[model samples]
Target: MKKEIHPDNYRPVVFKDMSNEEIFISRSTVNAKETIEIDGVTYPLVKLEITSSSHPFYTGKQKLVDTAGRVDKFMSRYGNRNKNK
Candidate 1:
């Protein structure tokens, strides 16, 4: 309800889900370093690692996303704990 409190740079931005390559457009003021053309129009592009479109909670399916070998690193560090038993 306050004037000049909200950002004035809100514009249509394209958000892409890297895991599934799903894209949707929404208004946002976030800065983007890329651009994407959809339907002959260019919009600021933002890449996301995960979103509701590719999330397990919304799709009811379990999925693993490993970007920095985190899963493998954790597995290597603790995967053999129960092997000796």
Candidate 2:
């Protein structure tokens, strides 16, 4: 691991907008524009979609979580499939 041999691995790292201490970096943007600062260093933010926040899972309170129309699609596909029968 020679310093001179290493070609100055200087690159930009991404940090999620308004995150506590989490950070990420990639080649492409996942979503709209956002800004984040880490250790006094500012960087562009990316996707921050939450699957489970202060919801049921973390608190061990398993609850039915319906998405947009998953159940509707399932019912429409399988439920109505045997209607003519």
Candidate 3:
């Protein structure tokens, strides 16, 4: 351990999984632009596309997370190439 090497801004932050709307609290130093109140206590809100709770590997299920039509765009651009084979 070293002195004055760790960040001092560690605090409780709320991480929300956008796919399943699952939320959990953990201490972090990451900056957040949004806030959420839980149990009458306000905490920084961080939105996540996927987490262990909703991930395919952790949940043993297949899931497709498409944000802003990214998956669609990718499929359109590259998916058709394989179909001709």
Give the top-scoring candidate (TM-score).
1
Kindly report which residue stretches of model 2 are placed more than 4 angstroms away from their true locations once superposed.
1-22, 27-32, 50-64, 67-85
- On residues 1-85, what C-alpha lDDT tens digit does candidate 2 reach at each position? 6658754544564744232334466545344466667789766676454333323565576656679988888898888766788
Against the hidden reference, what TM-scores do the models get? 0.74, 0.31, 0.74
Task: Give one digit per residue, the lDDT tens place, for model 1 in 4-73.
Answer: 9999999999999998999999999999999999999999999999999988999999867699999999
Report the lDDT of model 1 for residue 47.
99
The candidate, 1 or 2, that scores higher on lDDT is: 1
lDDT of 2 at 64: 64
**Evaluation by TM-score, superior candidate among 1 and 3:** 1
- Model 1 lDDT-worst window of ten: 58-67
Better of 2 and 3 by lDDT: 3
Mind giving the per-residue lDDT tens digits that candidate 3 earns over 19-57? 899999999999999999999999999999999998899
Candidates in descending lDDT order = 3, 1, 2
Collision pairs in model 1: none
lDDT of residue 22 for candidate 1: 96
